[model samples]
Target: MTSSRLAHEHDEHVCPRFHRAIELVGKRWNGAVIRALMDRPRRFGEILEAVPDLHDRLLSERLKELESEQIVQRRVYPETPVRIEYALTQRGRDLERILAEVERWAHRWLPQPSKS
Candidate 1:
């Protein structure tokens, strides 16, 4: 189907604010990062490994954006070398319920084909 047609289909099922929320979460690699963080805080290298396809520049930019929006918190430790980690803030934790629901929908409707 066309992009506009698919969008219209979504509009019929979602309100404007919820659609915008989905848009924010659906940005490139944003959802993947959020899903990764759902388990626990991760170091930058850990996150990079979890999202193997993510470019360092794009990942860094997305992390900073999420930090500015208060969705994620970045902690840096001072030492011989710097230690940094990213964890979800309370607001980000609130997204767990919504993300779970989306996960369920995806599992139900987007299942992968079984290998022969």
Candidate 2:
């Protein structure tokens, strides 16, 4: 068989679990949250500010879901004032290349609206 066919056959045999993962990451706000964390770890409020238009409830839900999926890590610092920050896990970092590609595609094909 040709290499291309072999690759396609291999993908065909793969289970739906992998597809489910993609679906989860592909959820609307999930990708943005991952992209934001790609820059650096951020606190809840910092993420909220970064995604100003996102509703607070939705952000909380997304963060919790990502955490449950082992895609994000929540760290709490013990100090005079407690601090919490969210950072991407190894699995989440794996999305960087994919996200970059999507961004490139959007810039190339998605049109900008008129200023008026």
TM-score of each: 0.78, 0.83
* Candidate 1 local lDDT, 12-68, one digit each (tens): 776688777778899888888888898999998889899867988898999998898
Number of the predicted model whose TM-score against the real structure is largest:
2
Name the lDDT value of residue 16 in candidate 1. 81
Tens digits of lDDT, candidate 2, 1-116: 89998799777786477679779989989989998899999999889888747888999999999999999999999977999999999998998999999989989999975566
Q: What value does the lDDT take at residue 65 in candidate 1?
A: 83
Model 2 earns a TM-score of 0.83
User: Which parts of model 1 are misplaced by more than 4 Å?
Assistant: 1-16, 113-116
**Model 2 lDDT, residue 84, Cα:** 90
For all candidates, the clash counts are: 0, 0
Candidate 1, clashing residue pairs? none
